[model samples]
Target: MRKWGPLVAVCLGTFMLLLDVTIVIVALPDIAGELGASLTGLQWVIDVYALVLAALLLGAGAAADVLGRRRVYAAGTALFTLASVGCGLAPGTGALVAMRGVQGLGAAAMFATTLSLLGAAYRGRDRSFALGMWGAVSGAAAALGPVLGGVLTQGLGWEWIFFMNVPVGAVAIWLTLNAVAPDGARGTRRLDLAGAAAFALFAGATTYAAVRAGEEGWTSGRTLAVFGVAAVALVLFGRAERRAVDPLLDLSLLRRGAFVTVLVAGLAYNAAAFGVMPYVSVWLQTVLGLSPVRAGLALLPLAAVSFVVAAAGGRLLHGAQARFVLGGGLLLIGGGTLGQAVLDADSGWASLSAGLAVSGVGVGLVSPALGGAALASVPARHSGMAGGAVNTFRQLGFALGIAVFGTVATSRMTDVLHDGGAARELAGGGAAALRGTVPDEVLRTAFASGLDGALTAAGVLGLVGGLAALAWVRSPGPEAETEAKAESERDRGDGVPAVGAGAPASPGGA
Candidate 1:
């Protein structure tokens, strides 16, 4: 108990953060119903959380290293808990979106420190065990969220999903304060708060552009204006980082082929793998008349397969080149998503089963390898920043993916129905509400076409990203050449066989 207590605390915090995200996926229709949220409102509900998380992750990690991991983790837990209360009590979409953005800030802080706290608490075999357990909890949290959310939403209310976080977070805080210890050392860099803000602006503006484009024409003045703002924010972010003494990210790393490849791979992997899921859930419940529980269950195969494959792949694929692994995995994801484009007007939930499972394999492969590849591609001094960068881009991908795909789904459906309002309603899973206004067969046909279009777009994105990663991913630095020379000299001196001669080195055999 003494040895494992800290792990429990970390697991609790991680579980809560991930669970909150997934539970909301299953509850979107319900939230839209109760709050009178439009399709755009629903998109923001998902996008804002990820946008904030991605924007603040780097700064949050730096704070944890400088301020003390235990303190930041505890404070983050408290903030997250309090924000969950606000979310639960929110009177409308505006209030709920605001609270959720706060929740993202807290999640970023808590998540940034979790592994560091564990590394400080354990060593050697215990470290591996702790990480494995952490992975298990994380996977279980994601797997359980939809089903548990369904039960709660069905039995209690959607608010219970947020309210449940109160007790869980309270316990996490108690454990953190009691069990976690101070770090052995601190990062010397100062915070890059300006960069964080600029990047946040960039992400927010980009999401707004995509969501707004769906309602107003893509070329509308408001959409174009926001896109211009996003581009400017991105430029300002780059400038700030280039000028900072200790930038949130060292912009110089972007010049490296390997590091940048890994970053894009991470982003594309997340977007293609998980972006369209909320819509899938909406379709199952709103169009097909599946209960929330059944809708949740429909998505379970992907999670289950990914978990199993990840567990087994960690050992089996260790020491392989990250380029091939990450690239191939992304290709598999693309292929799977492409396969799901088979959705026709007559298609059923079973039509998605094979594609989801295939994509799961890709998720399992890329999920672990992407981080390793990122860390391996950088100088030791920049490793922390690299980890934060990969994660930030990954979240950014999800945020953008949701908005872009929502636009695809909405636009295609609108083309079929020739009714923008009806398309938005259908996208939000309220198609049953429009039965009198639109024929059932017409609704199915338009939804099928829209979903198919979104899937094709995601698949093409993944394929393009995969091809780029494969082409550009080389060993990051001279580490491989240096290691080979040392091995050769050692063989002449002591005649020990070069055991890893052909592995072509990577992070944990990535």
Candidate 2:
């Protein structure tokens, strides 16, 4: 019971950190109006947070290993709390965006240290159970964010969405200080400044290109330039990784079949499920004429189904091999998302609810198991590194999901609403002004189709993921278990600190 408390504290922090990411999307309209933000500025509000977090995850994990996980974790929570306050008080878009970037840095710190702490606290079956619970909390937090955001935005204002984090962050900080144990102080390693900058540049340029392509045409010179920069940055990043003594991402990890397969499954699951969630809110409001609050209500069934299934699946995780659990879950997710492709303007509530439920169920089943499988393969000492790598890939998948699916949906929107010249320019003004002139049914039907098309692409991606999991994940057999046991025995003999000690510092302080 005592040990469980600390693990639960870290899990709570995980929930709050992740919840902040999705909670803002539904409130973007309100934020823009209140702050007088241009569309580009609003994009920065969303894009920069993710870009910074994704870029720094690896470095942050490495730092926690060297700098002391407890210190880093506490500092991150404090920073996030203070930054949230700054976000609420910011009078302009620029200040708000800057605060969000700071919040992302703090989140990166918190996220990078969590797995190591958990590994430090538990072992064997207890460790597995803790991880499963962590997955369940994350899933619940994700499902709850939009609904909570909608209610808050409508009732109070957009700023309250950020303000809401204050109490939660406070609790997380308090828990960490009392419950988590500090590791033996270790020396720092050399910071990989070049690798960090290169990765950020690559991700930022690519994301900018994707979002810009949605606003402008794909063929625009600006879009081409963005893509070119992304390509160059990626190439340079690869070169830096190869030459660095302590690479942020060890390319060799890709060769490990277990590691790579689970990572792929993680990426695939999020790509399909997350890509469509925000748009589901948009569809309910714009097409079905529901209010934001009502639109959020419509998603409750999906969340409920996912929550229930995820809890049950966590218990089953102890008895099952990850491949079967994850593969089956992906299959269901794919099936559910494919169902979206069949939706039309007149689709009944039962059908929509059923499809969403299926998706939720699939996600419930896979999210935990996939994450567990990935981290389980790495030595406990490498928990932070493994966690960072797993999460970075997942974030990349999420960003790509939104980018790619958003492109398809937006393109379809433009095609359906195509007017000769001047009329086409009118869509840029606002959907409200055009609402009166266009037939409501036609507009609804068009949006439904576009939404479905995006869902189809996501569904196909999930199916691809399922297939990859099946083909690539070699089932664990006696030989594998024997090898793992031998590895553990060898480590004990060599006097390496046990799995929960967290990683020791490299030769130099980074």
Best by lDDT: 1
Q: What is the clash count for each candidate, in the order shown?
A: 2, 7
Per-residue lDDT for 460-483 in model 2, tens only? 888888877766665446655566
TM for every model, in the order presented, reads 0.91, 0.87
Candidate 1, residue 506: CA error in Å?
15
Name the runs in model 2 displaced over 4 angstroms. 36-44, 92-94, 347-351, 375-384, 419-429, 475-510
Q: Which stretches of candidate 1 lie over 4 Å from their true place?
A: 139-144, 475-510
